[model samples]
Target: MNIVCIAWGSLLWKPGPLKLASGWHPGGPLLPLEFARDSDDSEELALVLCPGAPLIPTYWAYVDAPDLDAARAMLAAREKIHPGHPEWIGSFPAVDGAAVQPEIAAWLRARGFDAVVWTALPPKIAGTEGRMPSPAEAVDFLAGLEGETREAARYYVRRTPAHIDTRYRRLIEARLGWRPLHEAAVTRMA
Candidate 1:
């Protein structure tokens, strides 16, 4: 009965350490505690729409989707508008089933995404047959807070629009092979 947008991207700000990871929203970034401000926090969800960073962080936005179909359509529209937007991974409609990592991998591959960034994937979990969970299944896949590594934070943020030949990927790849840090942010960090 819940709807979520599962995306991977380099967030505007770094997630830093596991204990330091903060929840984000359109209003501004927020911490998980902020969501717990009320008892029915689970009913609410967020949708991240950032674009073109060296590495796009893989994250999930849990929005209240009373109609899963409608939510999926909305997300599809967003993807078409900005497929390269790091968070454009995909909209996931959570239902009763085990996690499917291969499905996600196939989806990325089909979409030309060579890699998916994540804090880490455990070897096992309940209701899951050791299959990898997409960002949507992460919270359900893991037992506790696992620090999101800088390596894991980075993802394919189309520094600019992309082409069929992957001119964008290659151009950026030439400038900076592959890492989580953004071109500009890297200099700032340096």
Candidate 2:
């Protein structure tokens, strides 16, 4: 089955093997993107589209996969989501035929894709499991992190797609209270 995985956050840039086929294109329906989901691997809370939040033009990348099961397994492994775990990633369904977004569905159908699987955590459900931290709290959370985890978070924020000078990115930066990458470089030079 021809499959495509939807990436809206960290997967956008660091997709591992998910980006092997056809690379990725800027596509998918606009969703309410926010950094509300707490990460089990890192201190920084990751972004997720929640219901009842203000909708924004969120970007998605599509990666081609010939095997649906393999693709799902790879994604699950990368995300560290056990099959039956009920935290966040597990809740996402592997939809077929682009059912999540009508426009994307039409395009995929036209391309002769056999299946489309998208995994995203809706904010409402995320809240039920555990409350997303506030901006101030998130910033405070990042303050205690160091080394590779901190660097990874910084890289993720810099690569994520959003409107120029997006509030989401700004909030993350301001909350992190870290100097911009450029500034840090200049400071090191001085």
Candidate 3:
């Protein structure tokens, strides 16, 4: 069964529960996860579109789930928060983004999103695990923000998610004992 997980608002701090359940990390937001400035290629991936608020009035589905019931159960997790869909899966233009501090802008590049961008590149091939982000990174970042106070939300939404910069690294290191990917140093592209 192929399941897709996504994280939009505050949950973007982690790569969503479904992403965790998928046995991999979602690397980051959609653009950074799938279209690396260094990727130089792109494809139409089955996006797990969470259509609705993180609190209520949400729904979800999968293309390869055994049935709707299973998909519903998967989304109905107390731990995972909101999960729903109406995700737009289609051809997206991808390019090898800068090999530097590039994912943030890349994520912004993929913006105008209706839902959260969790799993962009699902691991359809064998042996390869689903794309996950660095949990260590998230932890470190959160540690940094441990005492910081956030400003008021610009949008009508009260709170919005920020900084998944160093997330999901710990899980990758812990579960697989795999060293984290070496993030290329980067200057913000203007």
The candidate that wins on lDDT is 2
Residue-level lDDT for 186 in candidate 2:
12
User: TM-scores of all models?
Assistant: 0.27, 0.67, 0.21
lDDT of 2 by residue, 86-183 (tens): 23332123332222544445555666666555555433222354465566665555566689887776665555554423344576666665433442
The lDDT-based order of candidates, best leading, equals: 2, 1, 3
Indicate the residue-level lDDT of 159 in model 2: 51
User: Residue 36 CA error for candidate 2 (Å)?
Assistant: 1.5
Angstrom error of the Cα, residue 27, model 1: value is 21
The prediction achieving the highest TM-score against the true structure is 2
Model 2 segments more than 4 A misplaced:
58-64, 86-113, 121-128, 164-168, 175-190
Cα lDDT, model 1, residue 165: 19
Candidate 3 global lDDT: 0.26
Q: What ranges in model 1 sit over 4 Å off?
A: 9-57, 81-190
Candidate 2 residue-wise lDDT at 28 = 47
lDDT of predicted model 1? 0.29
Candidate 3 stretches greater than 4 Å from native: 10-20, 27-68, 77-190
Total clashes in model 2, counting residue pairs 3 or more apart in sequence or in different chains? 1
